[model samples]
Target: MKDYMGYSIEGRTTAISTILNQYSSGITLMKQDSNGEFYPLKAKTTILPNGSKSYILTPCNQ
Candidate 1:
């Protein structure tokens, strides 16, 4: 699956379409802190299954 920044998560990937099926709204923007913890930037964020935290991306205007 790919995020807004065009980063791809390969190998046994869960389709973003499938996720959207469950959450027709949108994907959550997450960030990892220096201590290695994931947190959402918005309150209305989607909680991904499997609790995977590998796909977090830095927010960008482009």
Candidate 2:
């Protein structure tokens, strides 16, 4: 993973797909809340017709 000033940077050249697929168990997706706190990010992936995948990250309840 690459970081720019304490933030994870995702770019076109980054191989995120492989990382998300192969090492997803180690990754805990997160989201920020209105109170300025972070929580786990729930998501689901769907396969497209072109053999590509799309992720739908569900909103945090709190």
Candidate 3:
């Protein structure tokens, strides 16, 4: 076991969960912490053209 503290933590330890449930629906968003990590959101969903659905997730401004 090595030192696991602060920003030194790996992905699982440092991952951040930022989700948009209302708009995203089945989709989820994972945000990285200051250290730059990753975590699973949840799942992806596709909507039919006839269905009244819109993607809450959009391109990042930055």
Which candidate has the highest lDDT of all? Answer: 2
Distance from true location, Cα of 28 in model 2, Å: 1.7
Pairs of residues clashing in candidate 1: none
lDDT of each: 0.43, 0.50, 0.37
RMSD of 2: 6.7
- Could you tell me how far off, in angstroms, the CA of residue 11 lies in candidate 2 after the best superposition? 7.3
lDDT of 2 by residue, 5-31 (tens): 123333311334334545666765565
Off by over 4 Å in 1: 1-24, 43-62
| Model 3 misplacement above 4 A | 1-20, 39-62
TM-scores of all predicted structures: 0.28, 0.38, 0.21
| Candidate that beats the other on lDDT, 1 or 3, i.e. the better one | 1
Please give, for residues 1-62, the per-residue lDDT of candidate 3 as tens digits.
11221343332232222224434546545556566775444322346589743222222332
- Among all windows of 10 consecutive residues in model 2, the one with the lowest summed lDDT is 4-13
Q: What is the lDDT of residue 60 in candidate 2?
A: 48
User: Among all windows of ten consecutive residues in candidate 3, which has the lowest summed lDDT?
Assistant: 10-19
TM-score winner: 2
Off by over 4 Å in 2: 1-25, 60-62
